[model samples]
Target: MKAIIVDDERLARKELASLLASHPEIEIVDEAANPDEAVEKIEKHDPDVVFLDIQMPGKTGFEMLEEMERVPQVIFTTAYDEFALKAFDYNALDYLLKPIQPERLTESLNKVTIKSAKSEGKDQKLSSKDQVFVKDGDKCWFVKLEEVRLFESDGNYIKVYFDKFKPMIHKSLNALDERLDDRHFFRASRKHIINLGWVESIDTWFNGGLLVQLKGGEKIEVSRRQSARFREMMSL
Candidate 1:
């Protein structure tokens, strides 16, 4: 994937570039010294990812993101850990502390590669076999599609229910619906998409809707508009 290193220190930029050289998947397309320069280069290169420093002269990394109309996948390269929690709120791909560890960098790159391929439509659909890396705050998980029981939309984020943990990831419901394998998952309502394998019971509800319960004991209302299709799929 194409990338740009945005840092104020020349040595810091060089060091990161050197480490990235060992990873064949990452191509260093450009470098920038400050927020202004970074913004200009990012628009010019349209890189897949940006290695951003949290602290810069004129602006912080988060401020830089606000300036972009279409922000790409961001991997924050900073010396502070305090901003780690806030970084995920921006839906950053990963957080790499300054003087980055090679192992950690590789882990972050793996996630970026998986996400980048899916975003670029290199993968038509994600099946039950596909694994996704999800990060909420400082916690992270590599979960297979089959393991998720429900996806509840909350504004711009989706609450992903898997096993016993419910973690939120930054993504829109409509965008995710297009990529999911319909045979294994169903969009039951405007706010929910459920895994068919987890359904435990189904019953009639108010206004021609259906009340569906999962093995995990969570109840979901299948919209009146979607109930017919749900019945058809279930009966099939």
Candidate 2:
């Protein structure tokens, strides 16, 4: 894939570029120091993917996205673990922490190049569907977008409820809502977000909210504040 390195530090950029050089599938088209330069180079190069640094001088990586009409697949490179969590909330293609490991980088590349292709053929889309990488202790799963029934707030982390598993990921529900496509996932209450596609039944509940049951038998309560929109979205 055509790619570019965007980092404020020259040494950091060089290090990632050098490692990327070993992969024949990845071709570095250009490099940029800050968001502005990155934007310019991106428009000029039109690379297939970007290795973006979250913390830059003027604008962070997210701020750079507003300048583009269409964003390419992004693999964020950052030192802060907090920012990496936020990056995942944005549904970024992948995240590589600083002192990037070769195995991790290879795995991320495989996801972007091979898994993404399979996802496209399998009908996963940015607006209507998505896949989330969930790692719980020693277990890992590449969860399909449709299978996600609900997302619950768990202190500083969000607990993803799907199938028979409930995995706690280091992200807030608000952040996850912002990343999720509105057409598929909606904030049903202060602490819960539900996937519309997974709702098997809906009924009016106390305080003007609605009760939703998923195919997997999980019952989620949609709060009164969002009930009106929920009804409209469900055409009721």
Candidate 3:
């Protein structure tokens, strides 16, 4: 599995890399001494796993992860046991306290191996019907396919509505549209995409547009351009 180590301390990075050398299955692709550099490396390489330090100079590991659209398997390595609880709260694979024991490191590496294999299969089968990892504030969920009601565009991000929460993901609505199944989802307007299954009612709106009401009580307006397709689908 391709991996990268992110730690502010240069010695920590070197130490982890040296220890990981014994595991031939893990290829050490790169290392970063700060969150900014790590972010750049992660974006450029897109490694399978990342050994991240919880507390860094500018950005914490959690802060860095928040910026990513799709996150890989993460194993947090930190000296403070105080953050261990918070570490796992984010669904991290493992948390190794420093100075990291060889046995502990080995166990974490094993977890990485298993998680990476699963992620590989998931990445290959990318579909809108597939589950996605989402986090908003202190809440997080692995949301399933059929539960999502709508996707609203918020500039560069998309707000995913599932269950009771609307989590913002760093992915464009247009990009998400390309991955979704057209039979199940429809681009109703420039700012909205509606799940056809969740649409509760439709009514004519002003200026040749149609207003769609969802089961969750959210309304989306279908533009004039898409009203013809919407009419054809709903025609008796």
Q: Compose the digit string of candidate 3's lDDT tens values, residues 126-184.
A: 34444455756654554555789999999988898887778787788887787677777
lDDT of the structure predicted as candidate 1? 0.82
How displaced is residue 168 in candidate 2, in Å?
A: 0.6
Report the C-alpha lDDT of model 1 over 28-72, residue by residue, as the tens digit: 999999999998887677687789897999797766765443456
Cα displacement (angstroms), candidate 3, residue 104, comes to 4.0
Judging by lDDT against the true structure, name the best candidate: 1
List runs of model 2 lying over 4 Å from the truth.
Answer: 1-128
Pairwise TM-score winner, candidates 1 and 3: 3
Residue-wise lDDT of candidate 2 within 94-140, one digit each (tens)?
Answer: 88999999888898888664323322322233444344456555344
lDDT of 1 at 175: 84
Q: What is the lDDT of residue 111 in candidate 3?
A: 71
> What lDDT does candidate 3 reach at residue 66?
71
TM-score of 3: 0.61
